[model samples]
Target: MMKRFLILSALISLSIFSSDKIGRLPVYKIAVEAVPATEEGIVLRDFIKEQIQSTSRGTISLPLKESESGNWEFDKEGNPTLETVANIKRYTDTDKLVLISTEDGQAVISFVDVLHRKLEYRNSLPDSLSKTLVSDFLGFLDKKNIYLALSETGSGSNAQLKINSLKPTYVAGEPIRFEIESAEDNYVYVVLVPENQKGEPILLFPNQIQNDNFVRKGDRVTIPDKRISFKASSVPSKDRIRAFASREEWKEFQLRGKKEDSFYRLLPPAVTGTKTTARSMTVVPNTLTASIEQSPVMEWEYQILSR
Candidate 1:
């Protein structure tokens, strides 16, 4: 009887860990409202909707109508009223309600948390409706969520990876240094992804140069050591560094066809099997065959400004 109970407990733990490794994202019901009548308003609304869907990896639900309480109200200028904002904060079912309004050629975006009844994020554009403006807004949203999720998932994990840069920003032609640390003995893989490019992530470790991605438990590893350095991209853009650690060896499966150029691509099966869309330049552990039950992944973002 005791052996059966132990087996059942192990199975339950494996189920929970496997679900997370396979990219089961937390679902959120998001409400969006924008002054769709005007050109700028339409642009803001469409961009927000598309970006939310993409960044959330389709984990968000968009309802066509407002909540039953009907507390969401907008002024004649299409701005959210204080009472409306309060009502959205008071509501519990909705995850967030995004309100976008443009006035005097400037766009304002606000993210309200209905459960917490607090203003999550508020930003005003610099009186322009360019693609860069939209990209910046979307990047802000993606970065915020990505960091928050990573923090929550990484906390209290048996095996974890943390990445830090030598500097806050990098310039063209400069070599960048990264400090990596792991909480447990695991094989660590690091990949550097430049957001401006549409190619495979540059594998920083376990390559021809280093040939070693294994780290001892509670050990600190630095990439591009004193003798070597990672060169910055010529183009200026936001980039990200993802570190995936596992108790077992991980093998990356390459994809064919149009993604042929991407050497580090995850196999099609891994993409289709996962619940969330995989990010470019990051490895999904479920794509790899490992004997272990838990595989944890973490990521950090930085900027590369043009000189």
Candidate 2:
């Protein structure tokens, strides 16, 4: 029986090859089991299941199976050992498994990839677990599987933005200078995402301090432009700067100010087009609007490592 199953699995793998290659793979039957039976564990299990189903988009099917008692066997570090792997394979008749466990008030989610014989993803949960983190994890998985489509196109010949920092790395208290150049008249949006600070995105452009998100074509915008200087955060962390340029003004989202700083209070969720991943910058050929026939949008990202 075991030999027959293995032969069948190999044959199926050879026969299936969908345009979305991941979709062609056999359905991964995953058993989600928690250790010590905690409420958090149960919640996390359900959340993972939902995220997998949502992100897969019928590409990678993860059919859930009832986990038996003592199904989750892992080492002290929350990794499956050889013995545990054998047991899981024997009991589930498959290798993929999600083990959720809490240690020292930190939840650890491990996705064991049996075919690769490695832990695909392992992360310590934050104090407040949000859907963003799940999306990030799912994105990580998609990237690992070479499933993300990072393609961009449109009439962006006149729309271009260049970003440059004074230094590649900076100290906590030092001031960082940025120089931006635009090829055409465009409205720009700049956002800084700090690794140390999760879920708190910093709006650099279009703020009260620098109220000019608009720039003329062939103009260069300099940060700390004689009037203002941008200082580094007190906390030591890595950060990423994303700059977006568009021919048409973005009316879909609104930025609100609180006290001295402005933030994106209501940003519309990005719509996923066919052959494109959500949150990815994809160009739509025809918006069918008067002011915007072909809304050309361009984006650039840069990493900043701070200590």
| Cα-based TM-score, every candidate | 0.42, 0.41
Model 2: per-residue Cα lDDT over 1-307, one tens digit each: 1111111100001011111221133234455556545787777767766655554421323434444335444565556776666545653444455667655667777677655445666767663653444555554443322211111222333337766554545544455567777777888765554442233344566655667778888777775455544555444444545455666676643454455333332222232222234343221211211112133333333233344
**Best prediction by lDDT:** 1
Local accuracy by lDDT, each model: 0.51, 0.46
Which stretches in model 1 have alpha-carbon errors above 4 Å?
A: 1-22, 26-28, 35-39, 55-58, 63-82, 89-92, 154-214, 217-294, 297-307
Model 2 lDDT-worst window of ten: 5-14
Worst 10 residues of 1 by lDDT: 6-15
Let me know the TM-score candidate 2 reaches against the reference structure. 0.41
Candidate 1 residue pairs that clash: 89-117
